[model samples]
Target: MYERKQEILTKILRAGRRTYFFDVKATKADDYYLTITESKKFTNEDGSFHFKKHKIYLYKEDFNAFKSILEEMTSFIFDKKGEEIISDHNTEQKFINN
Candidate 1:
């Protein structure tokens, strides 16, 4: 039934210019685990390309440690690499509404 499929939960823990996806899915024994995915969209010279994804699986027992490490790693990267600004100078939010 559709309800059975809906039982699995997925959430995005963090979203930046580089997006990360955290998804919870089932095992053969029906146990739950996490899948972490990094997705980056790119454009080719021809102007058409797809997102590149790198994924890793983490089990329930490791969730706490994994979350702590993930937070530390991203913090280190942010400290090392400066932040980026993305803006559309011509289009304002009110203008879009108008």
Candidate 2:
């Protein structure tokens, strides 16, 4: 039987109408992994809001490849468009990691 452990660390990044959650947790054997959850808010017809969340689970063995690709992709974007956000709906990006 396998069981998950409590979260070891967490971080929250708020970007406009969306929030990204980064959680570090351990597996049954005490191996560490990361879970990233992106939560976006949407408004209903009555002006009420709801949240939709999508999550990605990442393991240790693929960390290097994952990080390398992410860096490469972001670098390509920066090389093309620079750091400034280019959108009419551009909102101030705030990041909180702890």
**Top model by TM-score, which number?**
2
List the candidate 2 regions with Cα displacement exceeding 4 Å: 1-4
lDDT of 2 by residue, 6-88 (tens): 99999999999999999999887889899999999999999999999999999999999999999999999999999987788
Q: Would you list the clashing residue pairs of candidate 1?
A: none
Candidate 1 residue-pair clash tally: 0
> Which pairs of residues collide in candidate 2?
none
lDDT of 1 by residue, 1-98 (tens): 33343337665533433466767788768898887788777888999978889999999899899889989998887788755435454322211110
Candidate 2 to truth, TM: 0.90
How accurate locally is residue 36 in candidate 1, as Cα lDDT from 0 to 100? 72
Model 1 regions lying over 4 Å from their true place: 1-7, 13-17, 71-98
For candidate 2, the 10 contiguous residues with the lowest summed lDDT are 84-93
| Per-model lDDT | 0.68, 0.93
Q: Residue 59 in candidate 1 has what lDDT?
A: 93
